[model samples]
Structures are given as C-alpha cells and as structure tokens.
Target: MQLFYTPDITDSPIYYLSEEESKHCIRVLRLELADHVQLIDGRGGLYEAEIVDAHPKKVALKLLTRELEYAKRNHYLHIAVAPTKNIERLEWFLEKATEIGIDEITLINCQRSERKEAKAERLNKIITAAIKQSLKAYHPKLNDITPLQKLIAQPFDGQKFIAHCEPGDKQDLSKTLKPNSRYLILIGPEGDFTPKEIEDALQNGFEPITLGNSRLRTETAALEACFEINFLNR
Candidate 1:
C-alpha cells in the first residue's frame, strides 16, 4: 500500500493531499473514488482511508480508522557527531540512521572538525522522508551544530558517552548500555578529536567508550553507535 502523509485526519473524508502526492494518487496510481489507501502524518498516528475524490490536480481521502505504532527497542539513541567534509555521505548517514531508528541527533564542533556547520533545512527534509519510509511515529530531533565543550556542559539525564579515538578508554558501547535506557553517544570528525577535547568530555562526566574493532568514518562511527544502542531490539 502506498503511504500518504497528512498531519490531521480527525475522522474526515475528502482530505486534501499535497501537490506531489495528489499527482501520484490520481495520475500515477489511477486510484478511483472509494479506493483504499494508508496515510501517516509523520507523527505517531496512522490512518486507514479510501479515496473520496481523485482529481488529477487534487486527491482526497476519507479516514476509516487510525492507530499508533511504537518502536520495540528498549533504549532511545541520540547519535552526536561532527559534520563530515564529504556532505553527501553525511546526508546518507542521516537518512539511513533515521530509517533504522534513532531518538535524537546532534552535530558537534570538535577542535579537529573539518566542518562546523550543519544545514538544518536539508537534514530536516532527509529526516521527514526517513520517518515516512520507516513508518515511524516521532521524527528524530536534529540539533544545531554546537561546540564540543558547550554540549558537554548541558544537562543530559541518560547514559552519556563520548566516542573519541584516543587510546586507553575502556567501556564498550555494546556492553555498557542498559536496556530501555536513554543513551547519547558523541563521535568526532575525520582528523579525530584532540586530547584536550577528550579530556574535557571526561571531566564533564562523559564516559569514554568504543563502538567496535575496526576503525570507521565519522558518520559510520556515529551510526555504529546508533546500531549498538538499538541492538537490544534487533
């Protein structure tokens, strides 16, 4: 079933579809009046519907029922990382991570970070598609790019960890996590975070942790941490 997105469906028929979606339903799908379909609002709600009007310029639907779906994962994952120099790869990471499941995201600015800026608009679009594609209720929170020191100073309630490459850090992400807990993992850039950066994080009570054996890229490391925290369900 093709998924249609509408934020408000309040038991209404003849709901207006977006411009692109209108074309797909009426022109591409050739869905007729009374044809059944599904709709999600990019939030927690899902609506089952039937096409009430199928004008090529405007496709409308009537809601039959609505339900909510929740993720099975025991923990919430927030993968924080420095923005990549290769922006496309970073975009891919955002898309895939959302599809796989993540609670929140933060783009950090470490001392060695090649890029300090993250385009909130572009990332928002990527996240929107991921939520729809993955059939998820909540969209992951995308934080603005921030300094590493400042981020550490903020009060984070859950298990806080910093995934720096500097040697001698002990805890493993997989082993350290507790089921159903909220987790935040900080990953650094290509050149890697400086020693002082790691020291600051450690002093701020952020645990030094490792994702796995093989070295991974900045985005890969962030995503790997995401997978690790989410592994309880998988």
Candidate 2:
C-alpha cells in the first residue's frame, strides 16, 4: 500500500496535497479523480482519502476514514549517540533505527566526537521517509545536536545506560534492559568515550553496558542498541 505523509490535516474533511506530493500522486502514481489513497499524519492518524481533483500540480482529497494506531512497543526507546565522522553513516543509522523502532534520538558532541553538528531538517526527512517505508504510524522524534555533558545533566525518568568500550564490569545491553520499560541508551563516537566522559555519565546515574564482544563502529553500535531495546520488548 502506498502511504503519503501530511502532518497538517486541519479539522476539515477536504485536504490538498503539497505540490511535491501532488505531483507524485497524480503524475507518478497516475491516480485519477475518486482514486482512494492512504494518508498518514505522522501522529498516529492514518486517513483514507479519495482524490477529488486529479490535477498534477495540486491534487485534492476528501477524507473517507481515519484510524488511530499506537506505537508497536509498549516502552519508549531513546538513543543518544555522538555523530560519526562520516555523515552518511550517521544518516544510515537514523534511517535503520526509525525502521526498527525508536521513540527519540539525540546527537551528542563528545570530547572525542568528530562531527559536532547535523542537519535537523535533513534528518527529519530521512526519518519521515523511513516511517512511510516501514509502514509505521508514529513518527520518531529527532532532537537537535547537543553536548554530551549538557544532555546527561537533564533529568530522565526511565532507565539510563551508556555503551562504551572502556574495560570494566559492564553488563550486556540485552540482559541489562528491562522489558516494557522506558530506556535511554548512550552510544559513543568512533573513538569511544573518554574515561572522564564515562565517569561523568556514571555520576549522572547512567550505567555502563556492553554491546557485544566484537567492536562496532559508532553508527553500528547505535543501531545495535536501538535493535536490542526493540528486540527485548518484542
């Protein structure tokens, strides 16, 4: 089923697709007047719409039905990771994490981080595309890039964990995470977290966790953490 995104669906039953989306619906999809299409508001609302006007530049639709679907996981998964040096790798992680299941994501600038900033707009687009592609109703939240120290200072009600390579008695992530509970897991950069950074996180009540025996890249480790949380809930 082809799903189109339109976050702003006012109370009115009639809605017009954006210029870009209109072109795709009319020109690419060859949808004609009265053709039924699915629309997602990205806020858990899936609407069934019928094309009223088939204009390629400005297609209009009338809502026929609306269904509210909640997230698949009972608990929320929030992953904070330092952006990788290769921006593409970070983008890849964002896309995959959204497809797998993630509630929120925060990009952090660590002492050893290579990339300090990310395009929030671009990342949101990637997330939107991923949600549509994966047939997910809820849209994941993408937070702005923030400093590691600043992020840990904020209060979180859920369980907190930081995945690092520093040698110590760290529990396995899969075993450490509790099912049906909110989680915020931290994944470090390519160089991993510094001893001082690790200490700071621990002081903030973030437990140290291990991903696995094999060392993974920054993006890979972040995606692994995301997958682990979803897997446990499943």
What lDDT does the true structure give each of the candidates? 0.81, 0.89
* Model 1 residue 200 CA deviation in Å: 1.4
What is the clash count for each candidate, in the order shown?
1, 0
Q: What is the TM-score of each predicted model, taking all chains together?
A: 0.90, 0.96
lDDT of 2 by residue, 1-234 (tens): 468988998668899999999999888988899889988887888888999998898889999998887455698888999998898998999999989999899999999999988889998999999989987878999899889999999999889999999899899866777788989998999899999999999999999999899899999999988888888888
Structure candidate 2, residue pairs in collision: none
Best-matching candidate per TM-score: 2
**Candidate 2 residue 40 C-alpha distance from true site, Å:** 1.1
